[model samples]
Target: MLKRICIILICFIALLANPLQAKDIIFYGGDKNSYNHQILHHALSYQQHTNYLVKTYTGYAPKQRAYLNLSNQEEIDVVFGGATIEREQLNHAIRIPLLKGLNGWRIPLVNKKNGNIFKNLSSTEEFKQLLAGQFHLWSDVVVLQSNNIRVHKATNVKGMYQMLHKGRFDYFPRSILEVWSDMERHKQLDIMVEQHTLIHYPSAYYFYVNYQDVRLIKDITSGLESAIKDGSFDKLFNQHYGEQINKVKQTLRKTYQLTNPHLPPKTPLSRKELWLDLNMHPTT
Candidate 1:
């Protein structure tokens, strides 16, 4: 009888310890190697502050069309992507810039033989003469086309790289954080980074929750804000991206600023503490 009582007591204690164990939050994104996976893991790790445990599932959806379809179909509870007005209309955004506007700073990926193609390029008009590659559904396509820059649209990212290699486009502009790793990963293509130019605009990457997931939205927003307030967010950012940020600072690249017409009105641009300024060295 005593053993039976002890078993019951132990089971009760276990239940008490994990009262919300059944509440699982699903974070879906591309494969483990993708930046989306890193952001999902970092963002979901903070869910200990709420009554949920996060389980990540990598989906087959490509970068261009992942967020809307995944969230709308209830296949994913959370996703990370570049924030735009249309995207916010489709889902709820956490509004904290994940990369702190660095997504807007683009460096070109060009064939090794033509590495100096942008060396003497001085104006946006001259830049416009070169055709660039962009994803068909990406906000960057709109931004580039609006600036009078000719863009060749591709549905898949890997295919875009292949097209650039085949000279279907003059250059492929990729984020500074992404360009180096892409070049290394696709080394067989013999692409090199263009050292002379930087394409600048205002862009933000944010965590988005499904439209009906109010509890999740609240938890994520609170957790992210807490992480920011305590400096853990900055610490994590530097831990992953310090090398790239430092590389950009050391390079004498000429920057050309462009207006991002797709920027949402509610972007937290005034939150100075939430962003990393490339001009001001960020502390790890």
Candidate 2:
């Protein structure tokens, strides 16, 4: 009996020291200060709602097509991108709008000398005459081209910026959440925000997980819903983008509404609280 008791004690100690490990949910993101990093951090916050740990693997792919395709292969556990019907067919989208549809609110970047050029333009037809820079694979490219807007496609971010600097495009539309920081980083390129106009479309940014990883999808969906109900999601969004919203409100820019043909039919537009109404002035 004494020998049996000794063996049990040793086994219990070993179990204590080697407890079960938490499952790792791989996150593929961009470098620091990029929108990808912001999405990765938001995904990491979901960890509080699940036993699985989120681990970021940066620089997995520099282009949207590459990373999104990686998710299809199960090489990447999660990827953040604009929601589209085609994208939904490829991966399991969490379906919660990460930015509350703010990704569709585009502000343009243009040469400082030409900034005043857009101030007087009031129609999409006039805007279409100007060349816009965008990624070749971005859904926005399709939207722009469908609307008869001229586009200059670049495979990478730096190349796009260089193209803009070289006068290849008249304006580069950037999300309200991304334009400011991006401007600061590329100040040497001599671009300025087109203060007189903004673009509006119906779009959402969503976290898409591998279709085979149903467990992770459920965990993230539950976490996001809980965060929304508890107001934590809005708090985090306001903390990061509230100032930008306020600044946009102060500018009396003429907004041109564009149709996002790629938006999925099942988008949660009924959840009013999950979106920002540009018509109503932001109080933040």
Candidate 3:
């Protein structure tokens, strides 16, 4: 009993020394290797004085479950994903485009045998005629539908890939940041990235917190703004996506620029520096 008391006392003293830091800032729906996961910690690092304890959920949390957890503040503190007007109204969003609008640059995943099907795509109308696959809950679905593109909804990434491989959908448009990794992960499914086409729209991925968590909201927003101002945000972004960006710029592709009707009004459209100008892509 005496030894037990002594150990308990020591543990108490250690806890006193650390004071349990801030309420853990939990990220959901992604592992540490994901770009959003890296950026979350990176932005939060700018606010060391807050002493936030950053953690990621141990397994893949479905996007719906993550949002539910975030809404209840039960299991998640933040979620990173494409933004829409409804989402901004429901949560305390950091407003910084975590992907610098690169999430909007989409490349299609085609079955290997049909890889060259998009090579000569000449118009947005022609592109729209090809059926696309998207997770039903994603903002991308709405964007595609609003643009008159036909989309078949899938419940998960694996199923979507399977559907694409089996010809249930003509193509699955994945973000430029995601397609390479996805292609690598699902290589066994006989899918390939469409080589000669790119589809883009205006979109932003943001860190969102429950509306009641004002302190976290302020800290995250300030931290991201500080990171942006200091160039660390771009540095980190380039470190992860520089190769893809460079390749997309150099590639010869027919580009389709779509309009996102549901984009939140507060999106920093005026912040020219925060967005990549795909217009700079070579026409060749």
TM-score of each: 0.76, 0.74, 0.77
Model 1 segments beyond 4 Å from truth?
Answer: 1-22, 30-49, 58-75, 135-137, 154-168, 188-190, 279-284
State the displacement of the C-alpha of residue 283, model 2, in Å, after optimal TM-score superposition.
22
Model 3: worst 10 consecutive residues (lDDT sum):
275-284
**Candidate 3 local lDDT, 1-284, one digit each (tens):** 99999999999998788774565678874678877888788777777556776788765667767776788888788988778777776677788888889988888999988888887766667778999899988778888999899999988966898888888988999888889899899988978988888888998888989999887888888888888889888998999889999977777777788889978888998999889876543222
For candidate 1, write residues 47-166 as lDDT tens digits.
654456556665566654667665675567777778878788888888999888888888899987788888887676787889999999877898998888999999998798788888
Question: What's each prediction's clash count?
Answer: 0, 0, 0
Q: Could you tell me the TM-score of candidate 1?
A: 0.76
| C-alpha lDDT of candidate 2 relative to the true structure | 0.76
lDDT values, one for every candidate: 0.77, 0.76, 0.82
| Residue 229 displacement in candidate 3 (angstroms) | 1.4
* Native-referenced Cα lDDT, model 1: 0.77
Compare the candidates by TM-score and give the number of the best one. Answer: 3
N/CA/C clash count, model 1: 0
lDDT of 2 at 145: 85
* Runs in model 2 lying further than 4 Å from the true structure: 1-21, 30-50, 58-75, 135-137, 154-168, 188-190, 279-284
